[model samples]
Target: MEEEKKTVRAVERALEVLLCFASGHEWGLTEIAGQVGLHKSTVHRLLATLEDKGFVSRDAATDKYRLGLSVLELSANLWRSDDPSVALLPEMERLRDQLGETVSLYIRDRAERVRIQAVQSKQAIRRVATVGARLPLSVGASSKVLLAFAEASVREAILSDPAWPSQLDRSTVGKQLDEIVTVGYATSFEEREPGAAAVSAPIFSRSGQLVAALSVSGPSNRLTPDRMHEYAPAIMEAAHRMGTISG
Candidate 1:
């Protein structure tokens, strides 16, 4: 028990030291120690341990430490374990082909929905979202799908935000969200981006948590009201495929 306790405490201290680099600035031993409230010597030992593991690197010139490529390697490995984007690509491609419009996958990050993957339609006039593009979680079909299935606390927090886009009528949006949850998908027209329309459905993890949202999007001219309705089932089928395959 004593040895286990020591091991846990050491792990915690090491994590605390690493977190000092969260500001993205190179950190010196003194700065890290001060930030983590540990002795400089202890911080140095922790940094050395982390450096050996490739989580951080020390600059010989400035005697400062920055995050190392090993950290990125670990990040890549972690995401690769059950990456939603990777699992959804095949389905997204099928949906894009079927709808002949751009299909994007989004995952919520706090107040934002970030596009992690997109398959563009061959149509010259079709809409496209770049991977890593961050869009507001308060608007659009993908964002609405996320909110409709998000935890109550997250939903309340966004709805409570004073600076949330003024044009989105919450009452009307609330009713629409209820319908989205009931129907298992969302549709939006000219809400997030003017002249664009999208249909989105939630992708769930094995545990049934909403892991991401998949969307089909295009210019409103091509995705008119009837067309959006027409495309809904394909999008839902793709969403289901993503959820089924994604861990």
Candidate 2:
């Protein structure tokens, strides 16, 4: 029993080390050690094992570590089986083509929103999404859309958290979520990334539960609020179609 408990604890620590990268894409050994509250030696050993398993990659030049292809491969497998990413790709692609902007699918993961699938535009200048990338649920259009439709408990916890980004006003967020629900979509301009703008609509399950968000993102100059409003119908239509197909 002692040996089994040790093994379980080791596994838990390794998983915690891997999860450290979710906040930022890369980390140094000491940084990860600090983040996970483990000693440098233990973190190093866990990193070595994760590196060997292709779950993490180390930058030879900078000596920083980032998540590896194995993580995306697992995400792809989930996408294929029952994640709705595969089923929704065609709609995402079609929306990208129609809007001439990058299209992405996002789902809530605890206090974050994760990009599960993306279709890039053909234009020379456009937004590009990295699959499996986790973003804060505070400022982006997709994140707001997901939050607007999320369960009341989940919504309250995030809004009430003292760590919530200072730039966001909770009362305003409340109004924005209400507007998103009333308008059937949400738009953000330079809210998170400078020069970035997006319009997102919620995708619902057959039972009317929110499942994901479908978004069209591009340069703020191009995806202006006026333009985003113009594109809203198309995005909402595609989101509805995606929900229909998945259902």
Candidate 3:
């Protein structure tokens, strides 16, 4: 039992050392020990084990430790595995083919909307936002649709975060959110990225919980205000189909 306790303690110390890199700063053994509340010698030993496993690295000249490339690679692999991107690929493709533009799937993580999947159109003038890109919740039509349908507590928590970015047109967010709920979709023209227009609708699970958002984006010239009004119903219908399949 003593040996098991010692092992757990060691693991905890190791985790603390790794977490010390969360500030995006490099630290020497003494600094890490002070932050983690462990002796310098114990911290050094833990760092050595982590370095051997390629989870941490030390700068030879400064003797300061930082996260290693292996850690980043591992994180990327895990993110890909856990992402909703794979599940929404076929739907994205269908949307792209139907709209002759870009189709994207976005999900809210904390206070941010992350693009989990995208299918580009075959047009010569296609939009180029890639999968895995992140956007602020206050910026895009897709984000507004997502926030509008999210649980009240979740939306409140997101709005409560101090790190959330400010919106360019702050006055529209509240009104747009209300419209998203009332009309079952959201539309925008050059809201986030200039020269881009989008229409988004919410996807729900079998239990009637909002899971994510589906959006069709294209050049502003091709996606005029009149065209967006016409496309809103189509986007909403696609969202319903996605919900049925997802359920």
The best candidate by TM-score is 2
Task: Give the number of colliding residue pairs in candidate 2.
Answer: 0
RMSD of each: 7.0, 4.6, 7.3
Task: Tell me, by lDDT, which candidate is best.
Answer: 2
Error of 1 at 42 (Å): 28
lDDT of 2 by residue, 14-55 (tens): 999999987898999999999999999999999999999999
Name every residue pair that clashes in candidate 3: none
Arranged by lDDT, best first: 2, 1, 3
The regions of model 2 sitting more than 4 angstroms off are 1-9, 20-37, 48-76
lDDT of 3: 0.83
Per-model C-alpha lDDT, please? Answer: 0.86, 0.91, 0.83
Residue 28 miss distance in model 2 (angstroms): 6.7
- The sequence of per-residue lDDT tens digits that candidate 3 reaches over residues 40-103 is 9888889898999999999999999999888888877765533456666777787788789899
Work out the TM-score per prediction: 0.68, 0.82, 0.68
Residue-level lDDT tens digits of model 1 in 9-38:
899999988777766569988888888898
**After superposition, candidate 1 runs with Cα above 4 Å error:** 1-81
Worst 10 residues of 1 by lDDT: 1-10
Report the candidate with higher lDDT, 2 versus 3.
2
